[model samples]
Target: MTAPPDRRIAAHRPDLADRRLEGLVAAGQFVEGERWRIALASVPLRAAPRPDLPFETEALRGEVVRVFEETIEGWAWGQIETDGYVGYFSADALGPLAPEPTHRVIVPRTFLYPAPDLRRPPREALSLGATLALGEAVETRGTLYRMTADGAAAVVDRHVAPLDAPHADDWVAVAEGFLGAPYLWGGRTSLGLDCSALVQLSLAACGIAAPRDSDLQESAVGRPAEGPPRRGDLVFWPGHVGLVAADETLLHASGFQMQVVREPLAGAIARIGAPRSIRRL
Candidate 1:
């Protein structure tokens, strides 16, 4: 018999499945999902279609999602194209796919302005790694801004870089920037994030693709290392992961402290137990 699908990334349920899996999986119906782009700064992808449910991950602005189902209650069952994580997302957070992204936010966080001027009320706050489709540049006073393709908002020019720009050389330094950020169960934004998200986001800024969860990350991110952990090395536990910031320090979004923090490696091991493996990126 064939092995069962990994539901975390599988676009399947007892009632339906993506048409692409027609022969590989069994379901009551198969669909050719419609593509939709995330229009909000960030939207939660939950395991269920209820507000009370905690999200499994977050879909960033401009990311495409292939929607397999929609409900009148304002939920959509979809798979995030970037990470291939399937879940329920708010229908309102999605929009038509058009004017494809041209730039990506490179900073930890930035605000979207209704106008180019800083004095104007902000429209939304976007997090690192979010993509945007920008039009021509505009200047208000001494600051330069890029207008959104739809002209709905503007972003500071320095906050974003061309989508094709080179990645940062030090992803560990990128992760350090999130020190003190709140630990969130499924969040992937700078405002709040989980352990895996911290790893994924940091690597993404360095143009490296990583899986969305700790297990997948531990298996896919890097080759196994046999010696003492060094800076940029990823340390994995049973269900958690962190980066070795130095010979004796660990950096991670710690649920114990409820925030991202750096602490002595020995202390962390004492609290969380010894790491299962170390992977050098």
Candidate 2:
């Protein structure tokens, strides 16, 4: 009989596989792009492009003002603030930040950097998100700095808003994608990557500005003022470096190993024989 046709044929599933990014993707975009993120609740922008760079790093942050095509790449768009300097950026870089009347605060809280991986610490660290005694904290490049309760200066890689108001699980999800990137001297993109570049760019994509080198990255920010060890921070040995993990673990593009590898933080420190320092930034 013609009962329910033949059930053996596969129907075409286009939405999941046929999706096209709305802009020009870089050579690595198909594999390396971070998807489904939105900028934090605040940042300044304009309705028309100003005489400036359109995307932070070196330009002004722009809203998704308009989208067009260049016939060479893919979708071409412009971001204009209240002022007018139009610049071009790819559409794939666009997240879901609201494209509406822009807002500027007198005491501006967050500032995005060229490096995309920086972020604010999670809210558990802040004592009451509202109605708390707020004090002045400074930012370098795009990371935040704070003075200790006992009058000491400290810099922290953000894990909170402005950098991002990330939910708890987001950090771990992003870290997984960085596993096999090749080691680079000062490279930060997907091709030949280095330890600090991995940390910096990963955090930068989250709207965090991590310093570029191992020595600078390891200098500040983490749980202990000084450490036996800590995770999600950088570990340093004389002329060598790696990132720390929860299990007294470390990740680095080691010269001896000659590639990105993970090892015990204690073992790495012992092998290096008295590390010069550890930076939490």
Candidate 3:
């Protein structure tokens, strides 16, 4: 029989004992081999099956993953569809494989209400980039009812954009909205984000594809910009990166400040030292 595809994140994970998995796979009992969507606001993709394990990536609400295996402990081994990131998540976090997403959140954060009225308490807060399936438009109430992959229903403002819609040609403008978000090493949502995540999210909203890490990002969309720095350019250091807010201002989710913020490019250069290169996406 053929072996399971080698997922980079799953490589060398000691817990994935080859003999045990191979036996199950050869017997046709290893994986469910189904597609699913994330039902929660965010879920950790852990290195191990347990919650105590460290996570290097996350699955955002409404994103799809293809299940490769399931454990009795209720964990699902899978590969994220967006970037092919692989890991394990709680089985409870998954919902039925969804139809194509119809709309995407454009704001940093917003609430999903139980009904169309703002007077009612919100069911949950959805972070930026969460997608929704449009249900019904109730213009008079200034809200739109929507459905999730799990068949859950909620109402939100008409403020969302079509799923395929691009915010604009300038990616810098998209990055600016994340100002003040807390820094998280592998986060990509508005709840907490890292430098590469900020860049990825910003470019993604502008309909550009970006890789997950600083070095990968540097290799992906980067093209050396002629002349000095300018707005919308990307500046890379050894292990870090940031967006050019202007000719002299830089925006990034910095570990130094522990949050996303704007700082003078010269000051950042003086503190963080010289950038490896400045590229325009």
Poorly placed runs, candidate 2 (over 4 Å): 1-176, 219-227
Per-model TM against the reference: 0.98, 0.37, 0.84
**Preferred candidate (lDDT higher): 2 or 3:** 3
Q: Cα deviation in Å at residue 164, candidate 1?
A: 1.1
Question: Over the stretch 1-281, how does candidate 3's per-residue lDDT look in tens digits?
Answer: 76554444232233442232554333323343578998777788876688777666778778998787789999988877787677888999898665667888877787776656677788777777777776655543544545443445565655577776657676788888889999987787888889998998888778787877787788778699899898889999998999988658999999999999999999999999999989986
Instruction: Give the Cα-based TM-score of candidate 3 against the true structure.
Output: 0.84
Give me the candidate number with maximum TM-score: 1
- Ranking the candidates on lDDT from highest down gives 1, 3, 2
Q: Rank the candidates by TM-score, best first.
A: 1, 3, 2
**Tens-digit lDDT string for candidate 1 (1-281):** 99757888889998999998888888999999999999999999999898999979999999999999999999999999998999998899998899899999999999999989899989899999999999989998989999998898999999999998887889889999999999999999988999999999999999999999999999999999868888999999998999999767999999999999999989999999988999998
Residue-wise lDDT of candidate 2 within 57-170, one digit each (tens)? 111232233322222553322322221222344444344433321221111123322222245333211110111112246666775654222222232434222312442333
User: RMSDs, each prediction?
Assistant: 1.0, 19.5, 4.6
